[model samples]
Target: MSFGDLLHQAGGMGRFQFIHVTLLAVPILMMASHNLLQNFTAATPEHHCQIHDRDNDTRRLNVTEQPGPTTELLRAFLPLDATQRPANCLRFTAAQWRFLNPNATGANATRADVEPCLDGWSYDRSEFASTIITQWDLVCDFRRFQQMAQSIYMAGVLLGGVVFGGLSDKYGRRAPLIWSYMQMAVAGSCAAFSPNFISYCIFRFLTGMALSGIILNGVCLTVEWIPTNVRTIIGTMNGYCYSVGQLILVGVAYAIRDWRWLQLAVSLPFFIFFLYSWWFAESARWQILTGKPGDAVQELRRVARINGKKEEVDKLTLEMLKCTMQREMASVKSTYSVIDLVRTPTIRRITCCISLVWFSTSFSYYGLAMDLQNFGVNIYLIQVIFGAVDIPAKFISVLVMSYFGRRVTQAGSLILGGLAILANIFVPLELQTLRTSMAVLGKGCLSASFNCTFLYTGELYPTVISKVSDDEQKEKILLQTTDIEKTKPTG
Candidate 1:
C-alpha cells in the first residue's frame, strides 16, 4: 500500500539504502546459474574425470585412485577422439563390457576400479541416460531437444530484458519486478511436473518470463537504493550469494533427484520474496522525473528518515528533485528506441558487441557447467567446489573493478575464461589429479564472466528502461528447459 522509499542505481541513495540493494545481487547471481541447463545438464558424475590435483603452485599434481575411476573407465562411452588415445588416456569399457566395483574384491586393495554398468543390475541413473545423445547413440533429434531447451529460455530472456527494462521506465521498476516473482512461482512449480518434451519446454519458457526480470529489474532495484562509493562492494558480495545458492542446490539435489523437485526448491522461494512487494516503494527519482513530483517528494522524505536524517518531509522541495533529475539526464544523448539500436552506429555497435558477448558467455558458461555433470566427478562436491570458486572472483571484482574500469575488468574476465576453456582440451585425462584441478580452475574462470556481465549490464543501460520485464518473451524461454535434470549425462 505504500511506496517504501525512492531509490536510484548509481547515486542519490543513503547509507541504509546501500545495504538493501546489495542483497539483490544474490538473486542476480543465482539466476545466472539457476537454469535447467546449468543445474541439470551441466552436472557431472562422481566417476567421469581423473582427479589430477596439481595441488601446489607446481605443475605436478598428486594422483589418487578410487573405486569409480570414471575418467579412466568411461572414455569409450563418449565420442571424443582425444579421449580414445591408444596410450595416454584412461579408457572406459563398452556398455556390454561393464563390470561391478572391483573394490569389493578384498580388504587389502587400497584402490580398486568400479564399473558402473551392469547388464543384469540396471538402475535409473539419469546422468547416464543423457549420454545417449552426447555419445551420438541417440541421433540428432534428441540432441536438438537439449539445445532447444537452452535456446528457448535464452530467447525469452532477451525479450524480457528489453520489455522489463522498458517497463521500469514506463510504469515503475517495483511493480513488474514483484509481479515477476508471482510468475516465477507458478512457472517453476509447473516446470517441475513437466513430463514430455513439449510440456517441459513450455513450463521452462514461462519460468524464463519470470527470470527475465530477476537480473535486470532486481539489480536495477538495488542500484536505485544504494550509495555509489560502496555499490561495487555490495554488488560483488551479491555474487557470493549465488555460490551460496549453488551450495544450497547441492543439498536439494541430494534429497530430490527428480527435476521437478529441484525446480520447486529454487522457484518456491520467490513466492516468499513476492511478499516483500508491499514493503517496496517506487523510485522517487523515477517518480519525480516522470512528472509525479508530489510522490517523489514523499519518497525522498522516507529515505531521509531511514538514513537518520533530521530533515522534515515538508522541507523537501522541487529544487532538490530538479537537481537530481538534471544529474540523471546529463548522461542521456538521445532517447533510444528498439529501432535506434540498429539505426545509430554507436548504439548498434555497443548493442551487437555486448549481445555477442552475452550469447557467447551464456553458451560457453552454461555449456561447460552442463558438460561437467557428465565429467564423472562427485556431483555434489563438484557443485559445491564450483560454487566455492566464485569467492575469489567476487573478492577480485570488488578490488579491481572500481580501480580499473568495468570494460577492462570485464574484458579480462572473458579472456581468462576463454583461455581456461581452451586449456581443458590439451590436458591429458590419465593425469586425473591435474585434470580435475584444471577443470575446477576453468569453472572458476568462467564464473568471473557471469559476474562481469551483470555488473557491466548495469552500467550500460539507461535507468528508466533498465528494469522492465518482458512477460511474454520471458515465459517462452522458461518452457524450453522444463525437462532438464540436474544429473548430467556421460557418454
Candidate 2:
C-alpha cells in the first residue's frame, strides 16, 4: 500500500489534523498585516512649508485690530499652486502683504520670487498621529525615499523566497519556519523603534525575508500533512485567513494611529507563534525520503496516537515504512537539480507559463492594494473594503473551479482582472466613485487569481520537483523518487 493508505489507517483527518491546521493557520492572519502595513505606516498627510521666524514676526506686527482669516495670512507667505491650494514646497521670498487684502487676487503672484522650504515642513496629523512620512519629513523633495524603502523590503522578499525555499528542502520545513518566526518578531519590533529611515529600512528588509520563510514553510507543512482530497479546501481557507488579516490591520491601525506602535502591534504575536512552532512534528514524508525512516515512523506513531489510533499504529514500524516507501526511496537515489524543472520540454513550458501568471497577478495585486490613499476615501474604510472583497472573490473562485475547472477559472480571473484595471485609465479623474469601484473589482479578481494559481500550480508540478531540492542545487528530488516507483512492475 502507498503512504496515503498508511495515513488512512492512522485515522485520517481526525483531531490531530484539525488542531495542526488551525495552529498553522493562525500566523497567516498576521501575514496580511505585514504585507499591507505600509498603507498606514507610510501614509502621507496634508502638509505645507514651515513659515520663517521673520515671517511669523512680520505677521504679528502687521496684524490689524480685526485680523484677516488664516487663509488670507497664508496667502501672504505661500503661493497658490495650479489647484488653487497653498504650495507645499515653495514660499514667497518676502511676504506679499498685499495678498492679505480681502479682494486681492493672485494675478501678480507669479511675479514674486519663491524659495524652497528652508525651515522644513508642517504636517497635519488629523488622520495619522505619526507615520514614516511625518516622522522623517519624507515629503516634497524627499518623498521618493518612502517608495525606495518599500522597494528594499520587496527585494528582501524576492531573495527570501529563493533562499528559504531551498533551505527548507535541505534542512526541512520546521527549522526554517521556527527561525522565520523569531526573525520576524525581532526584526519587525526593531523596525518599530528604528532611530532613522536607514535603520528602519534595514529592519524592514530583514522582516520581509522572514515573511517568505514563514509562508513557504507554513504552506509546505500544512499541505504535506493533510489528506490529498482536502488540500484545495484547506488551502483556500488559508487564503481567507490572509484576507481576514487585511481587515484586522485596519482596526489596529485606526486605534493605534502611530506608525511605531502599529508596527510593534503586528510583530509581537510571532514570538508566541515561534514558541509553539517547536511543538510541530516535522513532515514524515520529508523525514523518510531524507533517509530518516526511523524518525518518520516515530512521528507517524505520534500522529496516530493523537488521532486516537494508538492501537492500530502498534504495527507501524520502520520495517513497514521502508516497505511502503521502497519505491519512493529508490526514486530519490538519483540526484537532481533545479534545472530539472525545465529539463524536459513539457515541464519547461509549464514553468514559463506559471511564472508569467504569478508575476502578472502579483504586479497587479500589489499595485492596487498599496495605493489605498489615492482612492480619495477614508483610508480605513477603503482598506476594510479591499480586505472584505477578497472573501467573496475567493469563495466564488472555489465554486467556479469546482464546476468549470482550474484552467478556465484561472484564465478567466486574470483576464477579467486586467480588463478592470485597464478600464479605469479612460475614466475621468473627477469620477472618484467610478475609479474606486473599478479598482476594487480589479483587486478582487487578482485576489481570486492568486488563490487559483496556488492550488493549480501545485497540481501541475509533480511532488518530486516541488519538494526535494537542496540549497546548493535547489530541486525537489523526493517526489522524483516516488514517481519512479509508480513506473515499476508489480510482479
Candidate 3:
C-alpha cells in the first residue's frame, strides 16, 4: 500500500489532520503576503521632475493641487502630451523658465530646449507615504531595476525550491521547514533596514528562497497527513489562505503607508512562525521510507493517540513499518533524480506539458497581481474585489475539479481566464468600472487555475518521485513567471 493508504488506515482526516492542515495553512498566508509584497514596496506612485527654483516648495503640494505659479511656468518648461498633461521625462532648461510668458504662443513653447529630470523628482504622497520607488529613486532610468528585483526574487525561489525539495526528500519534511521559517524571518527583517537598493534586492532574494521552501514543504506535509477523499478540500483551503493573506495585505498596506514599516510588519510575524515550528510533527512516511521505522512508528502512535484511535496505535509497530518499507523498496525499479523528469521519453512529454501549464498559470496570475494599480480604478477597492473573488473561485474550482477532473478544470479555467483578459481589450478607458470588473474576473480565473495546476501536477507523478522531482519541475517553471511578468507591462 502507498503511504497515503497507510495513513488512511491510521485514523486519517481527523482532528489531528485538521490541526496539521491548519498549522501548515497559517504560514501560507505569510507566503502569500510576501509573494506580492512587491506590489506596494515597489509601487511607482505619481512623480515629476523637481524644478530647481521650488525644490522645497514642490514637496509640500499634492499632485492634484499644482501650485499656480509653478503650474503656469510648467506650461512653458514642460512638453505637453496629446492629453495636455505635462510629459514625465522632459523639462525645459532654467533659462527657458525665465523667458516664458503666461500667454506664450504654442510656437514659442515648441522652441524651448528640453532635458531629462536633473533636480531629482517629487512624488504625490496622498496614496502612499513612501515606497521603494521613492526611497531609492527607482523611477525613469532606474525603473527596470525594480522589475529586475522581482525577477531576482523569483529566481531565488527557484533556487530554494531545488535545494529544499532535495533536503526534504533526504532529511525529512519537518526540520527543513523550521529552517526555512527562520531563514525567512531573519532575511525579511534585515530587508526592512536595507540602506540601498542592491542590499534590499539581496535580502528580498533570500526571503524568496525561504518562501519557496515554506510553500513546497508545507503543501507536501499537509498532503501526506490527509486522506484521499478530503485532499481536494484541504488543498483548496491551502490556496484560500493565500487569498486571506492577500486580503490582509490590502488592509496592511493601507495602514502602514511606508515601505520599511510595511516590510517590518510582514517580516516580524514570521519569527512567530519560527517559534511555532518547534512543535511541528515530522512526516511519518518520510521516516519509514528513509529506514527509520522506529521514528515512523512513534509519529504514527502520536497521531493515533491524538485522534483517539487507541486500537490503531496498538496495531502499528516498528516491524510492520520496516516490512512495509522493504516492500516499497523492492517494488521500485530504480531510483530517479530530477534529471529523469526529462531523461525518458514518456516522462519528458508529461514534464513539458505540465511545465507549460504551470508556466502559464504562474505567469498570468502574478503578472496581473503585481500590476494591480495599473487598472485605472480605485486601487484599494479593486484589490479587495480581486482578493474577494478568490473565495468563489476556489469554491467553484473545487466543484469543477471534483466532478469533471483535473484536465478539464485546467483547460476550462485557462480558456475562461483568457477570454476575460481578451474582453478587457474592448473595454473603453472611460469605463473604469467595466475594465476593473474584467480584470478581477481574469484574476479570479487565473487564481483558480493556479490552484488546480498544483493539484494536477501532483497527481501526475509517482509516489516515489513525487516529493523531489515533481516539485522541482513546478518550481523551475514558476521561476520563469517573473521573467515573463517582466515583459508584460511593456506589451
Tens-digit per-residue lDDT, 1-491, candidate 3: 55655676678777788888887888888776788898888888877676555433443343225644355455545676566667676777743543346565666756777789888877877788999999988888888998998998898888887788788878878888899999999999999999998899999999988888887777768776777777767778877888898899889988999999999999988899889887778987667656677888888888988888888888788776656557554434445577756765666787898878878878887888888778876667777888899889988988999899988999999999989889988889899888878888888899888878877766665444332366455422212100011001100
Give lDDT per model, in order.
0.55, 0.84, 0.76
Q: Which lDDT tens digits does candidate 2 get at residues 1-491?
A: 67676777778888889999999999999998988899999999987777766655656344321133355577878899999888989988878888777787778888899999998877778799999999999998899998898888888788788888888878888999999999999999999999999999999999999998888888878877888788888989999999999999999999999999999999999999999999898988878778888888888999999999979788898888888888666656765577877976667887899888989999999999999999899999999999999999999999999999999999999999999999999999899999999999999999999998887777677756543435655443333211111111000
What 10-residue stretch in candidate 3 is worst by lDDT? 482-491
For candidate 3, what is the TM-score?
A: 0.87
The model with the greater TM-score, 1 or 2, is: 2
Task: Compute the lDDT for candidate 3.
Answer: 0.76
Worst 10 residues of 2 by lDDT: 482-491
Residue pairs in steric clash, candidate 3?
none
Whole-model alpha-carbon lDDT for candidate 1? 0.55
TM-score ranking of the models: 2, 3, 1
Q: What stretches of model 1 exceed 4 Å from their correct place? A: 1-19, 22-33, 36-38, 41-122, 125-144, 323-334, 339-349, 402-404, 456-491
lDDT of 3 at 290: 64
